[model samples]
Target: MIIDYSEQLIVQEVAPRDGLQIEPTWVETADKIALIDQLSHAGFSRIEAGSFVSPKAIPALRDGEQVFAGIRRRTGVIYVALVPNRKGAERALAAKADELNLVMSASQTHNRANMRMSCEASLAAFGDIVALARDVGGVTLNGTVATAFGCPFEGRIEEDRVMRLIDQYLDLGLDGITLADTTGMANPRQVDRMIMRALHRLTPASLTLHFHNTRGLGLANVLAAYEAGARRFDAALGGLGGCPFAPGASGNICTEDLVNLCDEMGIPTGIDLPLLIELSRTLPALLGHDVPGQVMKAGRNCDVHPVPEYVRGL
Candidate 1:
């Protein structure tokens, strides 16, 4: 498929939610709010601020409400919260989330494992959540297909199945859809094929790609999706995210890396790269360990290295 190279891409920063959800160490509500505020200032139009799920399931993000309420919201930026069911939807709505990001794995095995429900049951519950969102009358909804590329237990996921899930999302009146590479199993070819198929059914603005760097193909897959006409993507700050339910999954596609790729390619992302890099650098101190992002370790291409001492003497 031919892609229009001139189009700008939208990058949704998901570090506050996805990035911190699986951390072994606790991130205080104050720190989460501070990070969200910083990201808001960095010019991300959409930020996954937090998730309204059971504390038992994801203890790392238990302070979703406080984080969302405490952050200084910037104009033109949409703060989103992940909602697993009607209850989560209520909490997100009460907290005044700009958008509710609903998720269900495309693979039956993964849905059963992560959500502890059948795919049919999950969809049924999502229908109820959508109704609640409609009644609330302010918040929008985005449906994410987890394990869209491949599943750890189920192996490769069928393209047709993913398309079907997209249909379901649209039927439920979701404002957007996100195809997630839950375990970093997507290749360029697969990404192109799936994205092309999805673009046929939805506009570029209504779709987003969420990738993981488990096997180090996250950025490659992003490029392929862009080539296939996908213009929106999700990345975590400092590459700090992985699914506790999806076995072998690693951190998300790095926000600075993706921004740098777009910046170098002359594609406008409207993000502040230096500010994002500064944020990435602070994660190690916050989490008490190094993060997976590479740009912080290897400076930008424009950053020059010092000449060797022998060459300088000569």
Candidate 2:
């Protein structure tokens, strides 16, 4: 299908939350706050600052409240927090999270494994969370359908199942919806098909695509989503993320790589690529290991390299 891509795309930076949640090394709360502050200046309209789930479940992000309280909140950028249930939603609201991102896997097996509940139970809990958000009265909610493309535990997910989840999200009055490729099992063709179907029912503004680079098709999937008229995407700095619960799930789509791709293609992402690349470069030292982002190693297209003397002579 021919797709006329939008001139502007919304890149929601999820590094602090999804990116840091599974890191083996502990990043200081101060460092995480600092990173969010820096990213806030890089023109991201939405940033997943942290998650409000049980610290026992995700020890890495135990400092979610502190991080939210510490960061210098920008005027236009919305700070989001991932919430698992009503308690999490209440905590996120207390922390002044601009948006709450609630997730449930489309595959029942995966949902049971990840959230320890049946798919119906998870949706019911999400309803309570949405009610809590309404009571709070200032926070927006985003419903994320995890494993929308495919699942490692359950294999391919059905399109009808995904559509039903989206219907639930809309019925719950969620301000946004995200289709997550939780294990990076999505291909470009699959992405296009799913997103096109979603677009038939939702607008570009309310929909977001969360892709992983585990199989090296993250950016390709983004392109496909864009072709299907999706304008919002979720990405992590330096591709620093994986799901400890989901088997074989690896890095998220790199924030720098996605921005660079948009810049090269004349797509307006409203992000500063050089600033993002600089942040990506610091991950190796911060996490005590090199990250998976490519832009930090390859540099931008405009970054010309000097020719070697031998090559110049030739």
Candidate 3:
């Protein structure tokens, strides 16, 4: 099927929250703010700056409030904060986050492990968060269905479970929902079917696709979703996140790689590729290790090569 070339896709950077959540080294709070500031200037309308959770659970992003407080807010850029329970949501709201991201896995086992609560309990908490946001009256709430694809622990989560979660999120007054491939178990065929079905219920503006590259099918699933008229996506810079709870999970899809692919496909992501690559190159030094993003290393497709000396002599 042909793509609609005129559609401009919305990509939310989840690196600050998802990417740094499990890191061994502590990312200085100033660096986190700087990273989000750079991303803000790079044309992203939404960025997941950090999360307000227990420092005991995720030490890396413990300074979530400081991060939200320090970032240079660009006009029209939404600074998102991930919140787990009512307390976390309260912290995010206090920090003046532009949006609150709520997460729960579709699988019962995964929800218990990741969220440390039963599915029903997590929903109860979500209800409180939703009411809080409604009363607060400015911040947008986005519910995320983690492991919407096959769950590594449970395997093959039923379609009904995912659909029901979407309905529940809507019923609770959440502005939108995200379908997350927590362990990257989704294939393109499955992605196409799910995207098509999800689009029937939610507008492209309200639904987002978050994929991990664990199985190397992340970009394929993105293409599949895009072809199915899904426009919003969540990606991490340098492909820098994995579930601390899920076994065999890898990083999220690299932001530069996704942007480069969109650039090639003539899809408009509105991200500055050169600036993003420059920021990505700084990541290796910041994290003290190499990252998996390829476009930053190899350069974009439009980069020109010089002729070899021997070839020039010929």
Candidate 4:
């Protein structure tokens, strides 16, 4: 497979929403706001600031409203929010979110467990949420098909099921669609074939890939998707987050790692690697645990040291 370097890919930073969702200690509202602002200055065109999910379900983000209100809105940055239903969409709209992201699991069992609703119910609710976003002039709608790869509970999800959901998302007049490997069950080959088929079926602008590093294949799968013509990807600052419903699942692909790979390959993601690394360093103190992104642990490939005087003399 060949990648087109001339094309510019879009990276949607999801650290605030997907990244911190699984942390035990609730990330303070101010910290979350600062993180978003830092990510904005790092040059992400779109940053998922917060989610409108119920505080009871995702307690880590209970301060979603406050976090949304606290961010410093940048000129070109588009702040997106994850909204599960019409009520969440309303809350997001009230908070002045620029975009609304709606998620539905490709696996029926995961869907029921994650959203507490059947797949059909989620699809039906999608239309309502899309309409709600439309009612507010500033908000755009994005639909995510979670567990597009293998699901922990449902095993391997069929390709047709994912395609059907994508078709439904398009029918809802959704502005974008993200295919999520919520369980990290996707491999490089699977990513290539599936993304290739999806590329043929959907426009480049409408498709986004969300991969997990649960099995350490996140970046490899991203390379496969990139080769398959995927230009939009979802990444977290420090490899944070996992699906609460998907047991044993880990974090999303590291933002710094993704940007590093793109940069080394001459792919113009428009993300600053050094700034992204700096932003990632704050995670250890902010979340109270070490993160798993490789680039953060070991500096970039081009990092060098000056020759010691003793060595030069020798």
Per TM-score, the best of the predicted structures is 3
Kindly report which residue pairs in candidate 3 clash with one another.
none
Pairs that collide, model 4 = none
In every candidate, how many clashes are there? 0, 0, 0, 0
Candidate 4 lDDT at 52 equals: 93
What is the C-alpha lDDT profile of model 2 across 13-97, one tens digit per residue? 9999999998889899999999999999999999999999999989999999999999999999999999998888888999999
Rank order by TM-score, top first?
Answer: 3, 1, 2, 4
What's the CA RMSD for each of the models? Answer: 1.4, 1.4, 1.0, 1.6
In model 1, pairs of residues that clash are: none
lDDT of each: 0.92, 0.91, 0.92, 0.89
Q: Assess candidate 1 and give its lDDT.
A: 0.92
Residues 238-287 of candidate 4 have per-residue lDDT tens digits of 89887776677668999999998888888899889999998898789888
Model 2 residue pairs with clashes: none
Candidate with the larger TM-score of 2 and 3: 3
Give the per-residue lDDT digits (tens) of candidate 1, residues 1-314: 65566788899999999999888999989999999999999999999999999999899999988988899999999999999998999999999999999999999999999899989999999999999889988888999999999998999999999999999999989999999998888999999999999999899999999999998999999999999899999999889898775566568999998898888888899999999999899999999998999998896766788899999889
lDDT of 3 at 39: 96
Worst 10 residues of 4 by lDDT: 1-10
Candidate 2 residue spans exceeding 4 A from truth = 1-6, 245-249
